[model samples]
Target: MPKLVRDRTLPALCPFCRAEILRPGEVEGGEWYDFAAGSCTCGAIFAHDPTARNGGAVFLQALLMVSGGDMDRAMELAEGVDYDVGYVQKYNVELHRLEPNSFGTLYFVRLRALGGD
Candidate 1:
């Protein structure tokens, strides 16, 4: 049996489980904003395409075509992008400049919009 996992902080609902959460939380600053992501408490899992949103696509495109694997510079450049959802960002362990390292692959995730929560 799959363990029940629940996380209401996700930008969207979990497809597998009908977990209900009030909503995600939001934080804001000058030219920057983020959401308080919820931890998955149940075993529910879902797959998402980072480039599904136009903002995500633009950022990913920049990271791949423009930055050419330059995650850091791409991140810096992506700051200006505004997503209807929330925003796009590169996330992962090991924060370093764009250099050859064991960091594997950089991850791009979409945050919830300010009022989405």
Candidate 2:
């Protein structure tokens, strides 16, 4: 079975509310906070904010997963996700744009989720 590892060091801030959201382990699954309900003691408000221009970490993570730890694959995945074939090819041609050399490692980890390991 594939194990979903949770970062134990995750901050108390909720991604949606920015409040100290309750941990899944702390309460039953049914009581988990709703994305719409941004209420929390920390006075954080819920904002359905879109990602930044650089595509952010989530995009990078997805890019790595589709790439299968291969630079070519990663570029292809990024292109496919971006819905631009030429952009992908161009990105691959210029590999210096992507940051954090660990993208390949992260991609491998994502592959494990799909039973690639």
Top lDDT prediction, candidate number:
1
lDDT of 2 by residue, 25-94 (tens): 1111222222111223422222111212333343443334234335576554433233221111111112
Q: Per-residue lDDT for 1-117 in model 1, tens only?
A: 999865322223322233432222232221222222221233311112222344444335423323334457546654325221222132212332122322222222332222143
The stretch of ten residues in a row with the least summed lDDT in candidate 2 is 84-93
Which parts of model 1 are misplaced by more than 4 Å?
1-13, 27-33, 43-117
Candidate 1 accuracy as TM-score = 0.21
* Residue-level error in angstroms, candidate 2, position 14: 20
In order of appearance, the predictions have TM-scores of: 0.21, 0.21
lDDT of 1: 0.30
Q: Give the C-alpha miss distance for residue 20 in model 1, angstroms.
A: 1.2
RMSD of each: 15.9, 19.6
lDDT of 2: 0.27
